[model samples]
Every structure is written in structure tokens, then in C-alpha cells.
Target: MIKLENASYSFKKGFSLSNIDLTIDDGEFVFLIGPTGSGKTTMLRLIYMNILPDSGVVRVGKYSSNSIKKRKIPQLRRSIGMISQDYHLLADRNLFENVALPLHVIGYSKSDMGDLVIEMIEEVGLTGKENHLPDELSGGEQQRACLARALIKDPDIILADEPTGNLDPVTAFDLVKLLEKVNAEGTTVFMASHNYSLIKSRNHRIVEIHGGKLRS
Candidate 1:
């Protein structure tokens, strides 16, 4: 579970988010929608502990989000999978290496790593591209590789910032459906997207952000 209470953030003397109050239950999927600069990315960043809230409280599972010690940030991040608006893959690494990066960092054995990478690649419907580099694949395929990496960790939560933003409509819909499937299996999902119509059709919980404040 994740909870944000009266949270606010500011940068360069400008407020990006304010007084945001929300609670996400375990195994639930939520769509966060708003225009660009409406604080959608900021909110997702807060959940992943990428940025600390200047005020208020953020609790993810049993961890303190904004107040955790610096060294603990990586550990905290490991517990939550994140996808960015752009596919953030290591250009130098093949799909397998990229997906296994996190598991390797945490010290999974070679055999375990290989198995896990294969499983994740299959999970994301990219079974035959494990050896391809990010540059070798199309944008949508690269995004799937990124998602494979995120889910390979099997984090407690999945926070995505427009995971399907750059994909074609059919690909985007498939990705959203995959996210829902992940939610069904008990991982909490918090997705930020500008595709309001797509989100609305799913009938999930939504919390809008505008001018640095959550909507009423």
C-alpha cells in the first residue's frame, strides 16, 4: 500500500505539487491523469522516492519515503518497479543483460539470472529478442524490454510515468491490459498518463493534478 498525505513539492522557487492526499490499496490499479506540467510525473517520482516531498507524509508499505536515509534510497527503489516516459535502457546492453541488471546488482546467481531474464522476456511477449540491443529494436519493443526489467524485480509496487506514451494505439492498449494483469496478481500499480479517454474506459480510480494541487 501507498499513502500520500498533504504532500507538496517545489523547485526553483516554484511549486510543482501541493496538498496531495491519496491512498492506494494493495493489488489495486490507478490511473493518474493531467496535462503536461500538471504534476503527474512529480507525483510518480515521489512514490518511487526519486524526489522527497518538501512537506507532508509519504508512506509506501512499511517504509518512510521522504525521510529515509540516503543509503536506503536504493533499497527502497528496489522494492518498487518504475517505468519512465522514455524507455530507459542501457544502450550498451542486450535485452537479457538489461533485464538482469537489477537482479545482478542484488547478487542473483548466473543461472538464476538467466532464468529470470528469460521469464521476464517471455512475460512481456518478447521471447526472441533477448539478445537484441535497445538500438536494434523498435520503440515499442524497447519499452517492453524496459517493462520486463521493471517487473523482473517483482517489486511491491509498479509506478509508471507514461509507459505507453510513445506507443501506437494498439500497443498502448495491450500495455495497459498487461498492467491490469500485473495488478490482478497482487502488485499495486500507479500509472501516470495523458490518455484520459483510455484511462476512463478502464474505470479505475483516478486522482487529477492541476497547478500543483490535487483536485477535489
Candidate 2:
């Protein structure tokens, strides 16, 4: 449900990601691997609607990302769950509030909200800490909260950039396992990670992005 054709992204004058042609099918778990500054996150930004590409075309769920309407960005983003290395959460809000924020913005009713929020919290294994604020949680807990928030949207595709970058090894492995479970249940996951050793055991389609091009 995500496609890019001859896409390229240029930031200022020194950095450019060129000739990116990628197609991610529904329910497929794909991994994007590379070193620092290799355009991995840049490619994801195109998919997540955070930035427009300098050239070429990108389409997701029948929407042309390069020119999608400003007002529609929220709708488009709701269709895809993005978990970047930096966990984006409202510090003022508690964990439950943060995860339920999306549903609330989308107009989910009180009856529907409780069960959905609780289900997502359970899935992410954060059942009891629902009342804790973002600042009260550790990095891993915050990341889990982010994951719960992402899943609550029930997105068609999940774009995670270094989801486990700073976690301990055990936590990182457990996190990937959680992702695998989500994938098994039909969420298409495109994970960008430099931790190849952790992912090697998963045996999913590994796509390497480096020097602004996709490696075969």
C-alpha cells in the first residue's frame, strides 16, 4: 500500500537521497538497514507525510503524498503509525491520555474509547501504568506508550525509525517480538534500524538504504 518511484530528497545543499524505488505490500514486514546519514529516516519521512520529496512520486492509500492537502495530513497520518527514535508524546498528558488523544481527535465515543484504549495498553504490556505521565516513565516505557498510541490507530502500515535505539538488549528483543506479533495479525511494518544483529534472527525481507539509493 506504499509505493515510491524514482524518489529523491534533498536537504539544503550537501545531502540528497536519490533514486529510491520501493513498494511495500499489505501485511508485509520489511526492514530498512544502514549506517548513520544514509537516508533511511529521510525515506520514512516521505512515507509518513512529514516532508515532501524534491523529485519523483510517492503514493499511499490512494493519496499523492507530494501534494496531499494540508488539512488531510491528519487523516493520512492516522492511516499510518509512525514510531520514530524520538518518542513524540505530550509531556503534560498521562500515558492513557496520550494514547487516547488520537481516538478523541478522531471523534471516538466514550463507549468505544475505553475498550480500545485498554486493549492497546494491554497489547503493549502497559496495563497498570495507564495513569503515569510521560515524564514519569523511563525511555522504554515511553517508547511502549508510543507503540500503544500507534497501535490504537489501527494503522494499515507502521513506519518505525529506530524503535529500539536506546533500549537494553533484552527490552529491544522483546520489542521486536512485539512488532512481529503485530505483523502476524496484519499490520505492515517498515522498520528502520541499525541493529542488524537483533533483526537477523527474524528473517524478514531486509532492504538496505545507503548513499541515497536502495541496495538490492
Candidate 3:
């Protein structure tokens, strides 16, 4: 489960997230809708513990923002997949290598890593492009590569922040469908986006945020 209790944070430039509370049960798919700079990314950052909250608590499963140790942060992150608008792929690495990077970080054996990377690539419809570099693939394909990398670890939850912001409408819809398929298989999904039309008809909980405050 993910929960925030009276959580608040502030940036030096004056933007702040006011006292906020939220809870997302396990195996749920939720949508976060807001305009640009409405604290969407900040919320995800807090959940993932990339930045600690200035007050109150943010909890993801067994980890809590108030007491989690620095050494344990990596372990917490390993169970949570993250996708963003930017592909964040290594410039010099091929798709297979890029997707395999996380497995390497966790010290997976060469044979096991190769099998996992290939399977994930195939899942994202990039099977034959394993040798292609990030720049060589289209934007949608790059995004799919990012998705593959995220899912290769079998995360308990996926935090996607405006994942479709860089693609065409058709491609964007396809990505959402892919996410939905992932959710159906029991991975929790919390996606933040400004495009209401893309998600309006979906049968999921929609949480809105504006000026750093949730409006659900």
C-alpha cells in the first residue's frame, strides 16, 4: 500500500505541496491529472523517496519516509518501477544493454540477465531491435524500451509521470493500453498526466492535483 499523511514539501522557488493525505491500496490502478508544474512529479518523487518530505509521512509498502535508512532506499526502489516523459536511455548503449543495466546493478548472472532482458524486450514489442541504440528507434519505441527496463525487475508498483507526453495520440493510446495490460496482470499503476481526454473514459480512480493540492 501507498499512503501519505499530512505530507508537505517546499522548493526554494516557493512552490509547495500543502498538507496532503492519500492512500492507494495494493493492486489498484490510479490516475493523477493536473496541469504542468502542479506538483505531479514532486508527488512521485516523494513516493519513491528520491526526496524526503519536509513534514509528515509518505509510505510505500514496508518503507516509510520518516524512518527509512539511506542504505535501504535502493532496496525500496528495486520493487518500484518508474517511467517518465524523458526516455533516460544511455546514449552509447544498445537497447538490450540498456534494459540489462538494472539487472547488472543488482548482480544478476550473465545467462539469467540475458534471458530476462530478451523476454522483457519481447513483451514491449521491441524483440528484434535489441541491437539498436536509443537514437535509432522512434520515440514510441524508445518509450517502450523505458517501459521494458522498468518492468524487467518485476516491480510491485509503477509510477508513470506523463509517460505519453512525447508521443502522438495513437502512440500515446497504445502506451496507455500497454500500461493497462500490465495492471491487469496485478502490477499497481499510478500515472500522472494532463491529458484528461486520454483517460476520461477509463474505469479507474482519478485523483486531481492543482497548485500542489489534491482535488479528488
Best by TM-score: 3
Cand. 3 Cα-lDDT: 0.95
- lDDT of model number 2: 0.89
Error of 3 at 204 (Å): 1.0
Q: Which tens-of-lDDT digit does each residue in 112-177 have in candidate 3?
A: 888889999999999899999999999999999999999999999999999999999999999999
Indicate the worst ten consecutive residues by lDDT in candidate 2: 58-67
Candidates, ranked, TM-score: 3, 1, 2
lDDT of 1 at 139: 78
- Runs in model 1 deviating more than 4 A are none
Q: Could you tell me which 10 consecutive residues in candidate 1 have the lowest summed lDDT?
A: 61-70
lDDT of 2 by residue, 116-207 (tens): 89889988988989999988988888888998898898999899999999898888898888889999999999999999998888879999
Candidate 2: clashing pairs of residues: none
Q: CA lDDT of 42 in candidate 1?
A: 87
Worst 10 residues of 3 by lDDT: 105-114
Candidate 1 lDDT over residue span 50-159, tens digit each: 88988998888887865688898888889899888688899999999999999987889998788878988999999998889999998788888888889998988999
Runs with alpha carbons beyond 4 Å of true place in candidate 3:
none
Which stretches of model 2 miss by more than 4 angstroms? none
**Model 1 clashing-pair count:** 0
